[model samples]
Target: MSNIGSNPLIHFAAGATSATIACVSCQPMDLIKTRLQQSKQTKDAEKYSSVAQAARTIIQEDGITGLWRGSTSNVMRVVPGAGLYFLMLQMANRRYRARTGHAMTPLHALLTGSFARAATAVIANPAAVAKSRMESVGVWEYKNGRSAVIDVLKTSYTRGAMIQVLGDVIYSGISFAMVNTTSPFAQKKASPTSQFIVSAVAGAVGTAAAYPLDVVRTRVALSKAQGKDAGIVAVVREMLEEEGIAPLYRGVEFVALRRAITTAVTWSSYRAITAAVGRARR
Candidate 1:
């Protein structure tokens, strides 16, 4: 186990594999969540009134395949991002354990998770911006994932990236603390089922806490894609004044469900892969 933790390749491989699986499984949910967040309700009409409506409209307008509109860009962002995150996490955890002569406490997990996620977000933000735009319900601007990414790279899209990094760092820290706390599962070797359960619980809690930030991030990303520069404060203020508070939680249900599924699958698969690699080396 210690050797596994020390192996950067193992961590990156496990993280990438797990992230690919998790993202593919929840891509449709992600598309819906983006659509819901990007939509606004007026006195007479709404772009997407509900999750079901969003799904139905997407299918009608873009075909059933539309449900996975941004999946390529999402994978481009998350695979390497998740790989780097796990590598950083393992390096941080190993150093912490060495200095303390014990496993990480919740506080340790929180700090390390925040640092790892923040660093990864900086590198992944452009791809993330592309993913959000590709998933948004509007004219399909880019021809492919590469074009979408190139378009984002050509713009000054820093505000949304800052907000996304902040929200993601906090979300990662909370989820890591929740999963690695001094609980029964944390105290002992967690089985795959236990890993899934703990990860699901952590994901749900983190998603709820960070969802408003997510909406803001999505708004800023899409706005930037359209050559608009809106700061976080301005975006939030506009949303509140024009759409009310409910819009901030537009796709909470879909996001919650997707996060739970993604976290559970990612952690369980990561653990299983690392454990297998450890045993193989032994």
Candidate 2:
């Protein structure tokens, strides 16, 4: 059988499917993270002091469904974002192998993952901004995903996208590098459980390292949505002035948890799907 990663269609399908499953399953965590990050900037600054408090407030105010408020927007962005990222990764790795006759080194994996994530962030930023707006407290007038996108399109969304791209590139690069350096998945004999565990650990490490940028990205998007200054510098300045360094890591625990779960699911599902396709082809 042909190598599964040789086919762009398989890569996209596996990536998109894995993203969808991860997004749907872990959306509540995302929502809570967004809410926590935005809470400090909102009028009700004390509304969500912690994860449990945020979750309780969401359930009480908007029902349990509120925990997934931005899920559609998130899925819209992440599905295609993940697909393109994996496709880019496959193409990059193939080219590297063709030229070097060696598997990607960790450094090469880092560069490839950074490029893929930055490209995806640029393309998917509007949807990401919409997702943040939808998830934040207040500014809940969006009737559907389309309306949210339209609203974001009408605003100054590019700065937030730029900030997001920076964070994502770092996070993706580090996570991919860590996986290549530490994971057992390179061995044909490696079990799926080991792969999953490795991916999760790598993701948690990456998330911890780059998580402050994530908070800034969310705040920038929310600021723009609220017609405030959303420039990266401006958002950082405001955050520092108002809440100091602590606010930048407000929801790190939740995001690290979410990233671990999402990365584990994505990689595991992608491997399973591609393996299944390879088997079927044979």
Q: Which has the greatest lDDT?
A: 2
Clashes of each: 0, 0
Residue-level lDDT tens digits of model 2 in 168-263: 999999998887666544445567778888889989988998899888888877774456765789888988887899987777888898999999
Q: In candidate 2, residue 87 scores what lDDT?
A: 84
- For all predicted structures, in order, the TM-scores are 0.92, 0.94
Q: Ten-residue segment with the worst summed lDDT in candidate 1?
A: 39-48
Task: Summarize candidate 1's per-residue lDDT along 237-265 as a digit string, tens digits.
Answer: 88899889998787787788789889888
Off by over 4 Å in 2: 184-189, 224-227
Pairs of residues clashing in candidate 2 = none
TM-score for predicted model 2 compared with the true structure: 0.94
